[model samples]
Target: MRIAVFIKKTTFHKGYGGIETQNKSLCEGLTKRGHEVFVFSPKLELDRNSIVENGVRYIFVSCAFKMDGFFGERNKDNWFTRSAQRFEEEHAKQPFDVVIGQSSAAVGVIKRKWELNIKVVSVAHGTIISEYKTFLNNMVGLREWIKIVSNTGYVLKSFFSRQREYVHGSEKVVAVSNFVKSALVDETFVDAQKVEVIHNGVDGGARPIQAHPNNQPLKLVYIGRLERSKGLQNLLKAISRLNNVTLSVIGDGPYLPQLARLVKSLHLSERLIFVGRVAPEKIPEILSQANVFVYPSLRYEGFPMAVVEAMFCGLPVIASNIGGISDALENGTTGYLVKSGIIADLRDTIREFVNKPDLIRKMGDAAYAKAQREFNLDTMLSKYEKILEDVVK
Candidate 1:
């Protein structure tokens, strides 16, 4: 079947975060299954606007922030009106069998379905509505207050409009987890039957390397965007409480500078290595070197891709017991899940792991087994293809 998958931006390993990685994986996975896949993303770089890889084709539409401008203020240009015009003009020569839009707010599929009379599917990655509300609620100060007042209605309207589209536009909503689907159903008032929970898969092609946690140096790794919601600060504080455990912070975001300052203030410069923005391809190697994989995300996450990757690499995950995280990792079985946002809980969890170093390998092996059983890329890809077929029929 011919499929048109829409995402906000397209990037390779070195480019950006989870959304891009997942889109790329899905495109490749679909192509591997002998399906004609076309990726529609905004052209971030000035160089090549279009590229075809393997059996998958990519068309990059012009947007404000290039690739990095996903949530930037300049994303208004990629709306349903503009994207629909571009998509129609580009595909006028050829049509697609199905249309799937990632990042549910990319309402271009809403226009695409209406114009082309095709099945459009919108995949909700996280609690976008709640996140927007949190963003609005966090706005403070005098001049900033003015900006919030002027644009508050617009954000609120856009949030509600996207919720409506996700509910009505697509054949059904593709949620990364039951947690995300529940959030959408409860918050957006979408019918529960209209949403399907498909967990994110890990690219297990990377060979797993064994690195025993020797008494020399215990390594802790966090691989994802270093945002405030990711609870990096809490991880840093926990690190400060412990001794001889060096943390290699992977990935980068707006919270880096503040986090760096915090690290300096806490005198954890030697203990913490902030290796900003490592590629997802190189993550398994990094995970192999570490004794523990820590993802202390405090916010409402859909399902963390990096954590699954870590588990696939046979690293015991130390993550917050929130959202779909608990669903993924069995508490005290595969990995330890601490209470979200509690410094004491995280600190204690870290200490527990530190005291019982041998338990790391046992939990890591269990996590690896779980990954092979449930979180393998092939299994996830098959499930997604079946869902698409079900939706299209």
Candidate 2:
């Protein structure tokens, strides 16, 4: 099958976000399965119009500005529309079987589906309103306030409305979790029957699980963006209350400065270590050194890839019991799932693991086993292929 994947950005060129990782994984996975895959994205680090690597083709769409800016400001040149035109021109000879779009790009492809005449699948990673609310929850100082005000029109006009159109316009909608599917149907008014829950998968072979070390000052790792919505502030607060545990933060984002200030305020400079952004190859190495994986996200995440990656590394997770996180973590089985944003609950949960170190190994083992059985990359690829094939038929 010939598949066209549309995403605003990808890890292939630059950035190390979950969406980019998933997009790359899916494209590579499908290509390996003998399907011809073409990924369309805005200009990337690679200075080329098109390139084929690992049997998957990548087409970079040149835009006026990067997709990481304010919504209204970034959409001025109709980047997605221009991208769709470029894709059509490139594939005019042999049409694609189906076009799979992620988030905002999905809306663009769906709007042009008439010209493309292909099955369009919109994969909802998360809702715009939910993301905005999370950002609003973490607002501090004049900079954040100005950002919110500047993006408000764009959020309402483009971001939010595009999500609605993407859900309603696409031939099929892929929700990363039941939580996301519920949001699409209940909040966005997408047809319940059209939405399918497909959880993200991780490369099982990417990392080797290390044996838990019997070391003092238990090592705790959090491996996502250092954003306010990620609940790192809550984690820092929780860590301040405990003496036996130290933290290793393994990503970078806009909220890093605020988090650093919060850490200083709490006087947890010695307890927490910010490792910044590391290559994907080094994630397992970082996770292997830790006894516990903490992801105290305050927002409704679609499905956190870091949690599953940590599980694959044989580390028990302590994340919020919100959205798809609950789907991945079985409280008391894989690890503990505390109430979102409650510092005391998170602190107590950490203390529980600190006191009962034995449960750490036991739960880590369970998490590893679950990741192998359910969240393997091959299993996820198979499901995705089936969905694309079925949609095409």
Candidate 3:
């Protein structure tokens, strides 16, 4: 099958976040399975406009940021219009078997899908509404305020203009979790039947169960994009209240500066270390060094592949029990779940692991077992392929 995948951006840095990681996985996995895949996406300033990695071609189309010049010429050259034009051009040359959209990144294609007589399968990583709420919950600083304001305006404009089209335009919507599925139907009012839940997963090839060193300070790791919605400030505050607990902050983003300031103000500069922008392939090695995986996100999330990968590394998790995060681990079994952004809840949960270190290995074993049974990447890829086949038929 020749697949055309439309994501907002094709550039990948897996350690940064899940969407790109999953997008890369999907494209590469399909290519490895002998499907020809072409990705259409906008390019950033520092990124190459075109590149092919792992047997997939990435076509960078428009600017990633919404930039428009005089007379709205740039608006006419936006992602939506560009992607559609490219799709038609490519389709005419050699017809595509299927079209895949990564969230609203395929908005351009879907907007014209029916007109072009094509099938579009849009993958919902998470809804803008859910993210908007999370951002509003963690609102801080002028930069954050700016984002909130801009995003609110985007939502309002998109809703009346193209939001519904993004949902209904596609033949099917693949929600990353039941949580995300709910958001599409309830929040966005898409019919529930149009959505399918396919959880994000990790490659997690065979590896030995983790072995932890005795007599070490509890090493806790948090992996995700550095952002206020991740609830890192409260996690840091919780860490500050504890003794002999060291943290490894992995990944980077705009929120780094504020998180850094909070780290110093809380006097956790030494213990709460920032590992910074690790590739996803290296994450398990890093996880092996730590005893616990902490994800204190304050609101909705698609299933984070980090959570599954941490479990694969045989580290027990302590994450927010909100959205699809609640689906990732068995409460008090594989790991523990806490109320999002509550410092006391986070502190007590970490303290539980600290006080009962033996539970770490025991829970980690369970986590590894569950991840093996459920969250492997091949399993996800197979399900996706089936969806594509069925959709095409």
- The models' CA-based lDDT, in order, is 0.77, 0.83, 0.82
Question: Over 4 Å off in model 2, which ranges?
Answer: 44-46, 65-76, 205-215
lDDT of 3 by residue, 232-346 (tens): 8899999899987999999988789999999988888889788888766788788888889999988788888888888988888999998898778999998899998789999
Winner on TM-score (1 vs 2): 2
Best by TM-score: 3
Ranking by TM-score: 3, 2, 1
TM accuracy, model 3: 0.93
Full-model lDDT, candidate 2: 0.83
lDDT of 3 at 383: 89
Candidate 1, residue 35: how far the Cα is off, in Å: 1.0
Cα error, residue 222 of model 3, in Å, equals 1.1
lDDT of 1 by residue, 1-393 (tens): 888887766674234777778778888998998998987776665467678887788877766532122244345664455566667875677877777889653466675576676787778887656566545544446865777654665556556665576567788788888888888888778778988888888778343444445565678898888777788888999889888788999888888998999999999988889887766567777778888899998766778888889888888888997777876899898889998878989888877777888877788888898988888888879988888898788
lDDT of 2 by residue, 1-393 (tens): 998898888776554698888888888988888999998888845688888888888888887544443453357556677777777886697988998889868566677788778778888888877677777877778988989865676667655477788888888888888888887787687779999888899887334344445568778999988777889988998889898889999999988998999999999988889999998888888888888999999888999899999999989899998777888988999999999999999999998877888888889999999999898899889888888888888
Residue pairs clashing in model 2 are none
Better of 1 and 3 by TM-score: 3
lDDT of 2 at 217: 79
